[model samples]
Target: MADRTSKKPPTTRKTSLYRLTDDGDPDLRSLIRPRYLDQEGFRARPVRQGPLRGLLVTGTTAPGPADWCQALADLTGLAVNEENHTAFGLLIVRTEKHIYALGHGMGHLMIEPARIDPGFGIHFAVRCLEKDRVTKVRRQIMDARGRSDENSVTSGEHIRGFGIEEFGEIVSHIAGKVRGIPLTYTGGDAAGAHITGNDRSVKLRLGRTPEDLMNDLLAIEEVCERDDPLPEFDFITQVRPLEAVSDLAQGLDARLDEMLGTGVPGRVGLAVPSECREGFDSAETFRVRVARRTRTVPELDAQTLLGPVSSCAPGERLETLRKGKVQMFADSDAEEVISGNVSAGRWLTAEVVEEGAHYFLWQGKWYEVGAEYLATVKRRVTELLARPSRITLPPWPKGEGEGPYNEKRVAARAGYVLLDKKNVHTARLHGGGWEVCDLLGPDGQLIHIKKAPSGTAPLNHLFAQARMCVETLKYDTGARRKFIAKLDEIAPGHPARDFREPTVVLGILLKEGEPVTADSLFSFAQISLLHTDNVLKGLGARLEVVSIGR
Candidate 1:
């Protein structure tokens, strides 16, 4: 590929140059963000050793060396030698607004570091295997292309510098996508493997390879542990579908409305603005969709960075914003649901962590919940604690721009209708830091819930949330007004007036399929069950493990 622009940057300079140069090039910033000290006003200065060394953030208020060094240590979780100036070969220093990093071979984070365009670099990928099967394949490819020297030193277990070739009869079913690029790497070195291609040259490599390129395609796709024929319940217990509980609530709500006729109130409903209230039809009152930035899910914005809800989308059920499985519903209504039950159609993360799991070794703490499911549960619990509105997944899918895909690159790509919920919102008392509970229940009862298999961490997290909800309600009596107001809006006719209070019945929907009780997940998570009962009893709320299987 030819270098198009003639404007060349100055060499042997400070970090400021990279920032200035990067502003005109968004791609440069993207490449630098993951590896270097960016945006924080880094300046380049000469160092005693290494190529064009010395990097630092510039500004009076910039964080200092202690902070940057600590950040580096935290990032890698490795100790650093401040005096030696060598850890990751990095001499990291930070002032008020300036931070500097310079290491041997140029650590790829500098503004216009050296000898690299790094344009998403070549997607070189090679797998490390104990065998040399790729050698014959590479030999065949070289012969076909009339090339030689298959064992070239520069092509050390890398995806680049190799012609795309057939993956052999064992894996010949694959299709090639990158035009004019081979899809296989048959290196001679059985001791090493890699999948790397530099962006410096498109002639070398381009586009993505199949994800499981090295997954011993010779074997059956599933050689072990397929879903048991007895039931999906055990697996469901291990991986609780977070959406399933909401679905049950919604399903129950829908069933109740249908059974009781016209205006008969149900346990679930949404509280949107009176004007937007019409969107919540009698049948659709079990509003499942909420804002993308709702409290239950992870908040993406920096200001709203209460916690992380990093999505592993296109997940088990093929649920992802990309797959159109996530629900980003259209709401020209509110920022979040003021008070309501989450519905079935809404997008929610699936719970994969069994109850009472721990990571005391990695976390270095006693009884820490260590599963992705629990992490998600914590966020959802936060949402429930906030008493949000019903949220839809695939939030109003916009074109390829603001939404899943935008092959055409439309004008409103990534566009979303920000309903004016900020205007008609209600008071949601924020609780202190807490973990996720599985259940998201009505406002009047014990709020926030989670399902835990046989473990103490999840149960602890659940109990803590139940305790917090009790405390919040006890402290914030006026919180009930918001709850009452939501009931008035959704239930109508003041039917909730007959409802009781203080004894909010928070349900932890168990994976206990009917006719099976003793071996239920709740039993496994019973390590802290009695303690949880004692806590909730003392705090003044009810906790019930209500199982509704699929």
Candidate 2:
């Protein structure tokens, strides 16, 4: 009857350093090397004012400016300025608690002269509430070791969380705890209730507690409400034994053979041979009855008896069969039969039976046909046969020091595989520019012949176009094949030259055998060179590899 739930303790913090100079070694000059004093081609310059500062809120009814500053204090221990405000943008809020810090424009924007500004510092923060009712229950369970009574305590806590809507789950859980007989709840408009069992019925009140009802239900576990008894025979000695005998006599093989013989007649007669006659003479003779065949009597036909056989040919005749006034026969063969009626005066080379049925003799066998159904089957078969096999190229190797041997591989390996070509192979060129090469298969088939372009395009557009091409190739196998094949078709008069010249052939080029340089790999992968240049410069690679004409 007591309140069982408890609260969780507050979290603790870890150690931190205020400043690097606070260490015992105060010679900060040792951390500064001679290279730090040397002025490189480009130097890091701090902005006059750092990143922008702003307060992001859900709505006007959102927690006041003080709440925003307070949350910031709790999160970073830093004071936030909330007095001055700027324009706000309306964002589509998809959920109850999901709200984003918008309009900062840090990463997803083009940096131009108009976009650049000083004294802009964006300080974004989030505030969330922590609830701990269930957390306290978990902590208590962890602390209480090897205790059965603790389980009941937790179960009571769980029941408190259950509302009226969860009545079924709560009843099932309580029933499981008591190991009581299953009970189903039923009620009508008059506030009535009943508990039904196999042999007895009990009228029950709707307002009793689950625990009390569970106790009563278990006490009458054997009692049931109704007895709609099943018809009984001597099951063990009579019914079951007879069924076992039937199953043994009609084993799977005999039953399957009986099913197969349903519509078919046996070709051979059953007779005792001379060798087996001696054994059969001593054995019990179960009288075997042979199936009788119906007699076939010849009927006289007017044409067969009065005229020559050729006048009323014995073989099927080719005739144009018609339904109503429409002539349906398309071609003729004497053995083909159209079994249906034909319009008089219509030419018929094959006999037509009905609109949906016809018979044709091919290779000495008669084949029945359904016109529309046959056409549908032919179409589906054609489509299945025409579907092109999807071919997936193996993933390009990752990391450095892999793939075919090359002497000038130190810089990087940049190449493209002509995936749709009959023979797929990677083409890698050092330095830069388009080069013609014969890509042959093992059997010497010219799978792909390509002439790639040289020179670099603007940094921003290079990666975007490469990604577009890769995505386009993923869905359009024909277009991918055409693009690869176009490489071979590049002539002086071709229109591709204009577009090809302005674009940078960006790709990772590995030395024939050595590990590809990080700079070259970035280029090959078509990552934004401008954005990654700062990072790559730190790794001892030239930020700018070569000028277009140089």
lDDT of 1 at 52: 23
> Global lDDT of each model?
0.27, 0.22
Per-residue C-alpha lDDT of model 1 across residues 1-550, encoded as one tens digit per residue: 7676875543221211111112232132332333344333343333433222233322222233554677789789898645322212223322222222323223333333332322211111111111222221122110111122333333232222233321100111111112112222322233332222222211211112222121212111121123331121111122211122233323432333232222212211111222222222112112222224333222111111111212222121112211221112233233444334323222111111224443111010011222553444344333333432332112122222221211222112232112111112224434322221222223333233333322223333454455555565455555545445554564354322322234443333332323113333222133234334445556555545433222
* Root-mean-square deviation of every model: 25.5, 41.3
Q: After superposing candidate 2, which stretches have Cα over 4 Å from the reference?
A: 5-460, 476-550
Candidate 1, residue 280: how far the Cα is off, in Å: 12
Task: Estimate, for each residue in 1-550, the C-alpha lDDT of model 2 and write its tens digit.
Answer: 7555665432211111000111222232222222322423212221122221212122112223754677887899788857533222211111111211112112111111112111011000000001111111110100001011212232233323322111001011110111123322222222212221100011222213334333333332222221211111001001000111123222421322232232211210112222222222123222111121111112111111112211222221111111111111212321222222222112111112334454321111122333443343344333322333221112223342212211123112223322231222222212222222122122211111111111111222232333333333344454545545665553223233222212222332222322222322212122223323322223232222211110
- List the candidate 1 regions with Cα displacement exceeding 4 Å: 1-46, 49-319, 322-347, 350-512, 515-519, 522-535, 540-550
Query: Could you tell me every candidate's TM-score relative to the true structure?
Result: 0.23, 0.15
Let me know the TM-score candidate 2 reaches against the reference structure: 0.15
**lDDT at residue 73 of model 1 (Cα atoms):** 90
Backbone atom clashes (below 3 Å) for every candidate: 82, 46
lDDT for 28 in candidate 2 is: 25
